[model samples]
Structures are given as structure tokens and as C-alpha cells.
Target: MFQPRQMTKLLIAASKDHIEEVIGELYKRRLFHIEDYVRNEQEEWSGYSIGTSLTQADQISSELVKIRSIINNLEINEEQLPKADYTKQSELSKKIASDLPDIAARIEAILLKRSGLEAEQKDLEQKIETLNPFLAFQHPLEILSGYETISFLAGYGKGTPVLPSESELFTSPVRRGEAFNIVAVRSGQLAECERILLDAQFQKVVIPQEKGLASAAVERYQQQITGLQSEIKAIDQEFETIKKQQQLFFVSSEELLTAEIEQAAAPLRFATTEHAFVIEGFVPTNEAVSLVTSLQKATGDKIEIQELEILDLNEEPPVEFQNSRYAQPTEALIDLYVRPKYTEIDPSLFMAILYPLMFGFILGDVAYGTILLVVSLAARGFVKGSEMGTKLIQILRNCSVSAILFGIAYSEFLGTSLPWHPIWLSRHINMGGSASHGVEYVSHVPELLILSIWVGLFHITLARILGAKNASVMEHGEHRSKLMFAHIGWILVMWGIIIAIWSYFPLLLMPDLTGLPLIAGISSSALFGGILILIGIVFIARDNVLELMELPTIISNVLSYTRLVAVGLSSVAIALVTNYIAITMIIDPALKNFTAISIILLIAGIIVFLLGHTLNTALGLLGGGLHPLRLHYVEFFTKFYRGGGKIYNPFGMIRKYTEAEK
Candidate 1:
């Protein structure tokens, strides 16, 4: 539970004739994480170079591309398709490869035709828009453009100009509500005509050379647009029907070709001589025997498998975590920081426990917790198939349960106390002349702060212990140095300081200190703590004197945990204020008598209550989730973890859209 699974290095050698069989068997077992071979002139294995698998790889890849193209063109939805059988995948790929060209060509031809029709349709629509404004003019469009002796300019202006009808240079000004469509003909003095039009803010309009009235041209274009649209719709319906018939085949063929490509390209990672090949990888210790047996059977005992001991310090093996379902969600949190090194301890189990515990302490309210729990459960159901989404839901669900448990202890429901008596203490008791039937939570703030500090102390101590254990494993059979003793001495010094402070400074935070033997206990604890500190300094001094600089940091880290209490107190205060305004200012006045004003106040009060509580709940989630994660990542991980290991990735496919043979 605390460590990643054990792994062993595997080296396999086989004749060229049997190499393919060996690769296939290893891939089927899905036990090995292959290591690419590196050639060194000084080593005996240097004579062998990477094997040639490119020819087979290219053929398989080509088939895969064709299948994917077909599937994309058909717009197949994977969710609605039936799963393909793995046993029949080879036959399916071969069949599609042989028969696909004819059907695909037909579909391509129709699509090309549709594309041309769509372009024609767009052009026709643009022509209709350009012609609609000129429909009122009953002249041929060609005549407007082809006059050589008379200069005819058609344009729009803001208003109709007061044309001198007797003038020779300009004629025919027509107006319609801030828009003027006018034609100016100049037999001479074209510059004066242009000046008159420019004064009215005219914008020129170009008329196309068509030998018909503007309305007749627009009608002709509209008819062509309707014909093209009908043709495009017919082609689209045909394409849809073809897709419905061929989508399953295309999807299955793609899957088959992809798997084949992966299998055929496996030899690229191996080293090969003229007649033999060698491959190296890591396999889980438990799977070693079974893998060897399967490979031996598949290759008819021609392949040799050897388990090699890891002897190089620079060669780190890949890491694979094995955690229970309850602890698995914490893996996502841990990954956000860094993966634990192969030899380092796995901290997911510890994270699963402490993260929610801290979050619950900060957000102790039964009503908010219940809402969080429901939301998380609904999210889990909605995202059931997504790994990260499910893990996030699980983390939220765990925190919600913790919050509810702590809320019961605090006797709080959405920041106010219930009428029923608390198992421990209620925050509302004995406030401003109210009867003191039970103990109040406000008076216990000091105790909660002390408890937060104590939690930090315990958490850091566990980190040190785990760190020591990892050090022992990494430095197995080595002689212990003074650094080892220094590490142990620090743990003792921390505990000693905690004890001495609790005994001697009880008056600072403890409400009831009459039972403590102050003089005797404080004296003995202070002496023991002093001795422990001196011993730690002596041991650490032999390794490096600079480590003494970090002694003050230990105290600061522990004090940082006090935010748990501070944040929780803030939440409680906000909730109390929300309730006070709703009850005293709105609800109480409304209940005095039934009137329109009272009813309006009652609705306003309910709205305020809901909005305030909703906002408080959102803040609670942010603070509760983030602070615990900060404590873990920054303070806790620094002690025991030094993560930079690569994750394990074995060969073989876990097919989502296909079923395996029995």
C-alpha cells in the first residue's frame, strides 16, 4: 500500500525467424514496458542495430488512414454504433480494403457535384440582392452602361437634388425617404454634373451588363437558385443514406488497422544482428513467470528470456501505483504535484485520510454539507465513464461526509444552532442574556486553535518517519552515517518541544490548567527538551553545520496550520449574520400581521436567505478544498517525497469499441 509495485528487468533473445512470434506473445500478455536499445561500441551488444520494420509499418498505416478518412466523411457517431468483435477484425479490415474504393469514389463524385452547386447558389443569391434595389427602374441594365456619347452616372444620394430640368448636363432626379436613385446624363460639362452630385453626398452604384429589366434579371436568378438548392438537397439525402449503411464497417476497419500497425511496428524498439534479435524491457515481478511461459509456448522454445538484476544507480525503473478504490482518487491530487520515484513511498493513502479531515474541520455545517454531498453524487453519475471526473467527484463526496460528521459535533446547520441539543457544544448558547442551557462554541476557539497546531505536529512527524524509511531502503546495506542519527534526533526534538510547551505554557491557551502539576512537570520537560535539542545539533553538525539555519522554519510551518481555525471561524460568523438579517429585519416584522407590505417583505427575506447561504457555500468549497491541498503539497510533500519517475506504459490495447474473443 505504501510503495509502488516491484519490477524486474527482462531481456529476450531470439532468432530472426522467431522474433515476430516473441513480440506478439509479449504484446498479448501486456506485461512489459519496452526500453529502446542504445548502441555502444564498447559493449558486446553494440554489433546489433535497430531492426527494419518500416515496410510492414507503412502498409498497415496506409490502410489505417483510408479507413479513418472514410469514417470521418460519413460522420459516424461512435456512441450509437454497435461494438465490433476483435476476432473478426482482421477479416473486416481486409474486406473493407478490397471493397472500399468503388463505394468511396461514388460518394466523392456526388460530394464534388454538391460543392459546385453550393457555389452557384451563393453567387445567384448575391446577384438577387444587387438587383432588388434597381427593380423600380424599368430600363435595360445594358443600356445604362453602354452609352458612349452621353455620360450616364447612376448613384444614391441622401435626398433628391433640385435639378434644373432645363439644364443640358443633368436630368431625372428621383427620391424615396433619405434615399435618392438618380441618373445623370451629360452631353457636355461633365465636371459640373459630377460636382452637383458630389455636393449631395452621392455614392456610385455599378450596374451589370444584362439585356433585361432589373426585375426580370432578379426573377431569372431566383429560379436558378431554387433549382440548385433542390439538386443539393437530393445529393445530401443520398449521402446520408450511404453513411447509414457504411458507418459501422468504416469504424471497425479503422480499429483493426490501428492494432495491426502497432503489432507490426514492435520490432523497431529491438536490436537486431544479421540473424538474431535482442529486446529489453521491465515486467512486474508477479507476472514474470506467466510471461515467460506464454512466450516459450508461442515461440516453440526458440526464444530465451532472462531476468536481470538492476545494478546501475542511474537507471531508474518505471513506477506503477497499486491502490485500493478508496485511495485511488488521491492519485489525481498527488499527480498534480509530481509522481513518486520508483523507490520512494506512495503517499496516496495518507492523503486520502488527512485531506478530507482538514476540509471537514474548516467547513462544519450540516446543511451545506448535505448540499455538497448531493451535488457530488449527481456529478459522479453524470460523468461515470470519465476517470478524472469520477475521481474529482469521489474527493468531493469524501469531504462532504467529513463535513457532515463535524457539523454534528458543532451542532451547526448552515451556521446557526438547531433546537435539539448538541452532542458537544453549540455556538448560539449564552449570547447576550440568552439562557445558558449548554456549553457555547465561541468560548472554545482557543481549544480549536490548539487542536489545529497539534494536527500539524502529528502530520509532520509521520512525514519524517516515512522519509527515514525510504532513506533506509535506498541506502540498503550501507553503513549508517551521522546524518541518519541527525534525522532521528530532529524527530525527538520536535516531540520534546511540543511536550515542554504544553506543560509550561498551559495558561496561554488552556482554559482549565488547575489539574496540571505545573512546577515539577514543566521543569522536567524543559530539561529533557533542552537535552534533545543539543543532541540533535551535535549529530547534524557532523554532516553539515548549515542545517541549523532551518530550525526556525520548523516552528513557522507548524504555526501555519492555525489557518484551519481562522477560516472556520470566518465561515461561522458569515452564516450567523445572514440568519440575523433574515430573521430580525425581515421575517419578524412580516409575521406581525398579514398585509401587502408584509408579504413583500417575507418574499424578499426568503430571497436574501437563499442567496446569502448560496454564496457562503461557494466560499466554503473554495477555502476548504484549497487550504488542505496547500498543506499537503507544500508542507507535507517536502518531507518525504522526491518525485521524478516515469509512469509505466505496457504494450497492448484495452479496446473500448470492440469485444474480444472468448
Candidate 2:
């Protein structure tokens, strides 16, 4: 419950011929986390290859690429497609070997034709646009291009340019919106003509290759474009139909092909020799026996599975946490910080208990709790079958339950007190005040602060106990005993200090001991507390003298829990102010008489009340959720947890698009 699952290293050796069988068995069982064999060039024994070469690996990889490309080109949305039918391995292989080639060839041909038509369409559109400017000129394209001696310039200018009479320049000026299309041809001294055109702000335009007027050329290009567009539309429709027919097949084939590629590449992780192969991996200790039996059976006793007796200090085993269903959701929170090392304890169970408890204490409101519970329940249904969503909903549900329990104790519904009596003294209740005005149980600052400190003390104490247990697991001999004693000393010192504070401080919750006899008797607790502190210091000094500096830190850590009370008080205050304004200024006055002004004020007050409460609830959730998590992560987890372990990743498939037959 407190620790991660134990792991054992398994060294597997088999003949080259049985390597495939061994790999298949291990993958099917999904029990082993393969450790890639690293070859040390300097060591002769490490230089040998341990696994047989995967000759089909490259072929499988190529097929996988092609399959992915086909799927991508089809733009298949797996969510919109129907689930694929389950097919045997042999059937799938044969279908892919025979049918895929033909399908791919046909699709490729269509795509190629579509690409050519698109290019042609684009070219025709460009040609038409280029020829549109010359439409005003009534001249053949051949005439415009054939003249070598007479240089002709056709382009748009800001206004018509003055033609040079001596050069026999023909000017065709046509207005086009804000600009004029000018076509001029001169016989000689073209440089002077060009300068005049440039002075008129003329920008040159290129003529198309068609040997006709610009209008005729545009008409011809448009007809071709229309034809090409029709062809492209037909090709797109064909693609759509093909996509609908083959999306499911492509999705299933991709999964199968990917799996095959992974299997073929498995040999790359093994160390191979001329006739034998060696594979090293970690498997759960509980399942090691069954996995070995299965592998032996699958390989016909050709493979040898040996559990290594010694673990290398440099190599850390992969961690797999085994937690109850209720505690599992807390793993997500734990992972957000760090994954526990294989040697460290799993804190999910502890977090499961503490996280919600603190959250409820911080957000103690019946109405908000009810709302959260409803929302969480609805979310659970909506996010069914999604692992992350389910975990989040579970956490919310637990927090909501805690909130409700605390709300009842606090006698709070939303930010106001309900008519029902509280099981315990409500935070709003003035414990020592008169009852004539009806005892108001507002969460007094001092009381809440004291409660928060005590909670913090208890939480930190538990953390230290767990940390001591974890230390005992990792240490040995005299060192383990010394660490354990130090942890005990710290625990004693914390309790002693708490006891001494209760006696010495004139706290609201504690009884007064002012007389000489009472003072003398209670002073012993302070003395006992001092003695415990000295004992703790003595024990921890052996580990490191610097650790003594942490004594003040314990006080600070306990004080940090005051955030719970501060946040809860803020929420209550906001709610109280909201209720006061709504009731005293608007709702109460309006209830006296239903005048127009009063009714208007009443409606406005209702709006203000709802908005204010909504904002307060949101803030409460944020503060309530985050501060509790901070307390656990920063103060609690740091005490015991040394995370950063690798997760176990086994070779197996959890098919969603397709299933295998039993």
C-alpha cells in the first residue's frame, strides 16, 4: 500500500533461431520492461552481438511509411469512421501484401493527375490575368511580337503619354479605372521614347504567348480553365468516395503495420552472438515465475530465463505503483511533482486522505459543496472511459464530499449560516459571548489560526514517521538505527513543544493556569519540552550538525497551514458582505412595499448578490485547491519523498480501432 511494486531483473538467453519466439512471448505477456543492452568496446565479452538480425525490419518500416502517407493523403478522421472488423494476422498480412499495392497505385495515379490539372489551371489563370490589360488594344499578338525594328511598349500609365511624331509612334490610350492602358510603338530613338513613357509613370507589362488579341486569348484560357476545374472537381469527388470506403481499413492496417515494425526492431535492443542471443529486462517479482514458464513453453525450452541475484547500483529498476482504486487518482497529483523512485514509498494513499481533508476545511460551505458534487458527478458521466478525465472527476468528487462534511460542521451554506444546528461549534459562533443575540459563529481569526497550526503539526508529524520508514528501507546497520532514533527524537520534540505551548500560552482554547501551584505544575511541561529538544539534537548531530538548523523550519512549516484559515475566512467575509448589502439595502427595503424604485433596487441587488457569490466561489475553489496542494507538496512531500524514477513501459498493444479474436 505504501510502496511501489517490487521488480526483479531477468537475464534471457536463447538460440538465434528462438529469438523471435522469445520476443513474441514476452510482448504478448506484456510483463517485461526491456533494458537496452549497451556494448562496451573495451570488454571482449560485451562486443559480441546477442540477437539475430531482423532482415524484414527495413521492409516493415517502408510499409509503415507508405501506410501513414496513404492515411494522411486521405485525410481520414478516425473518430468519424466506423470501427474496423477484427481480422486474423495471416488475413491482414495477405490483404496488405496484395490489395495495398493496387490501392496505393490507383490513388497515386489520381493524385498525380490531379496535381497536373491544378498546375495547368493555375497557369491558365495567370495567363488570363496577364492578357486582361492588353484587351483595349485591337492588335494581333503576332504583330506586337514580330516587330524588331519598331519597339512596341505596352503597359499602364497614370495618364496618356505624348507620342513623338518623328518616330511614327502609335498611341492607344484606354482608361482603366484610375490608370490608362497605353500601347506605343516607335521606329527609332527608342531611348527618348522610353524616357517619355517612364516620365509618364508607365510600368511595363509582359504579353502572353497566344497569337491573337488579348480578349481572344483570355477567352481561350478561360475555356481551358473551366475544363480543368471540372476534371479537378471529379477527382476530388472520387477521392471523397474512396476515403469513405477505405478509412477504416487504413486505420486498422496502420496499427498492424506499426506493431509489426516494432516487433521487427526488437532485436536492436538485444546483445547477439553467432548462435545465441542475450536480452536483459525487468519484470514484476510476483509475475516472474509465470512469465518464465510461458517463455519456456513458447520457445520449446530453448530459451533460458535466469533471475539475477544482484542489482547494480548504477542501474535503477523501473517503478510501477500498485495502489487501490480509491487512491489511484492521487497518483496524478503525485506525478505532477515527481515519480517516486523504485526504492521510495508511494504517497498516493496518504495524499488521497490529506488532500481532500484540507480542501474541504478551506472551502467549508454546504451550498458550494453541493454544487461541486453535482458538477463532478455530471463530469464523471461525460468523461466516462477517459483515464485522465475519470481521475480528475474522482478527485473532485472526493473533495466535494469533504467540503460537505466540513460545511455541516461549520453550519455554513454558501457563505451564510443555515437554520440547522452544527454538530460542533461553528466558525461563526462566538464561544464566550452572550446567547441573547443568537450566538454568531464567525470563524474568529485567532481560533482558526490555532487550528491551522495544530493541523500542520499533525500532518508534518505523520510525514516524519513515513520518512523514517523510508530511510530504514534505504539505510543499513548502525546508520539505519541512528536515523530511526533521530526521527523518533524529532517526533518527541514536536509533541513536547506542542504540550508546552498549550500550558504556557494564554490561548483561547486552553485552560488558565495562573496560580503559583498551577504555574509550577505546568512549567514542568516546558522543561520536558526543552529536554526532548536536546535529546533530538543529540541524536541528529551524528548524521550532520547542519541538520540542527532545521528546528526553526518545523515551526515555519506548521505556521504555513494558517493559509487554510486565512482563505476560508476571506470566503466567509465576502459572502457576508454580499448578503448584508442584498438584504439590508435592497431585499429588506423592497419587501416593505412593492414600489417601482424598490422593485428595481431589489432586482439589481439580486444580480449583485449572484455575481458576487459566483466570484467568491471561484476564488474559493482556486485558493482552497491550490493552498492544500502546496502544503502537501512543499511541506509534507519534501520530508519523505525523493522522486524522479523511470516509469515501466512494456511492449504491448491496447487496440482501440480494432480488436483481436479470443
lDDT of each: 0.76, 0.79
Query: Candidate 1: RMSD over Cα atoms?
Result: 4.4
Instruction: Let me know the TM-score candidate 1 reaches against the reference structure.
Output: 0.85
In model 1, how large is the Cα lDDT of residue 386? 73
lDDT of 1: 0.76
Cα lDDT of model 1 by residue, 387-456, tens digit: 8788888999999999998888788887776565565434442334432223244546666778788788
Model 2 CA deviation exceeding 4 Å by range = 41-44, 50-53, 83-85, 124-233, 312-315, 381-386, 425-441, 477-479, 485-503, 510-522, 576-614, 657-662
Please report the candidate that would top TM-score against the real structure.
1
Worst 10 residues of 2 by lDDT: 430-439
Error of 2 at 332 (Å): 1.3
**lDDT string, candidate 2, 421-503, tens digits:** 76644666332342212336544668678878878888988988988987788777888878877777778777766766755
lDDT (Cα, 0-100) at 306 in candidate 2: 86
